[model samples]
Target: MVQTVKLMKNRLAMYGLVWVLAMVAMACSSDDGDDNAGSREVKFEVTGNFTGQLNAVLITASGGGTSESINALPWSKTITYESNVPTTQISIAGAGGDPGETITVKVIVGGKEKSSTPGTATNSGTIAVAAPSYAF
Candidate 1:
């Protein structure tokens, strides 16, 4: 009878261990369908010698997932996109420069300024900053 009890105790201990490991495995398993899985907030800031020349700026990120226009100078817009998004686009519009005249454009992402490149005012004095790679 003592031997049987001892065997039963050993089985109980083994069962307890198995139960703990199973619980741990369940805890470690990730639910890929989480709503916040790829979520992140990205900020785009438009600034420059806008002065009276700057009228409105268009910003788009994540393939139109987030887009808006700023009708004021030194404007900023914050948007959220998946961390996997590759790039974003910006466009600046104004009424001061000549058609097709070169204008300076500045962009800031995540509170840090991005490098400037040559942008030209359109026939309507609009300029585009195409597909800048998004920073994760």
Candidate 2:
């Protein structure tokens, strides 16, 4: 009888282990068909009548990366990102331009303008503009 009880206990432990493993596997599995299910088209544009070359021009790209341009007026960038984050930031900065020059930054998502901001160069010829945070 003692041997039978030991065998039963071992079987019960094995069954419990199997159940736990099954639960873990199910928990780890994804119900969504694809990990990159939803994607967004993001575009950043900078336009202005700033005279002279723009220095240190910086623009944000998808995946929180940035790209720089020099003397590139009316610059724009587009990216497609499958992001889980609810919001993304878009901005632009330039220096060494003519004083009192004007600059405008825009953030477009899915071909719709989401945010726009205007900036002017300081007396030292520096300007920075940022669009409102884009919500997906």
Candidate 3:
């Protein structure tokens, strides 16, 4: 009888060990796909016409509770920005050419772009803001 009881206790201990290992595996195998839950990177592509002494373009990005201004870009450049929010408002403006001499501007974000059609950069003119979708 004592031998039978010892064998039962060994079996019970083995079962407990297996149950604990199963629980650990189950806990370690859950992944909800939110690896970037805190921050994400966004890219900006700025391109425009900088002619006749206009060598720089002013780029501004604001939104997601923050604001940034890049005041001197070489008319065509890419900017990488990091943010926790997935949408940002960007703008470009310039002035240095003759009257009606235009400076076409476009901003690319999240692989999407928005252009300022007929963006006129007259002696004292500007352009509006462009908002694009982003992802994290």
- Candidate No. with top TM-score: 2
Query: Could you give the C-alpha RMSD of every candidate to the true structure, in order shown?
Result: 27.1, 23.8, 28.1
Off by over 4 Å in 2: 1-39, 52-62
Badly placed stretches (over 4 Å) of model 3 are: 1-42, 50-74, 110-118, 123-136
Candidate lDDT scores, in order, read 0.45, 0.56, 0.38
Model 1 agreement with the true structure over 1-136: per-residue lDDT tens digits: 6776445444533443444333333343232344433334545556544432443223234433222334554566676655554444444444444666654444445444454545666665445443243333
Tens digit of per-residue lDDT, candidate 3, span 1-136? 6776445444533443444334333333221235443333334444444443322222223222222333444344555544422333333433333555454445444344442333555555433223232333
- Ten-residue segment with the worst summed lDDT in candidate 1? 51-60
TM-score of each: 0.41, 0.60, 0.37
Per-residue lDDT of candidate 2, residues 2-93 (tens digit): 77644544453344344433333334322133333343676778888876444322222333333344356687877665565344554455
Stretches of candidate 1 exceeding 4 Å from the true structure: 1-40, 49-67, 94-104, 118-126
Provide the lDDT at 135 for model 3: 33
Q: How accurate is candidate 3 locally (lDDT)?
A: 0.38
Which candidate number maximizes lDDT?
2
State the TM-score for model 1: 0.41
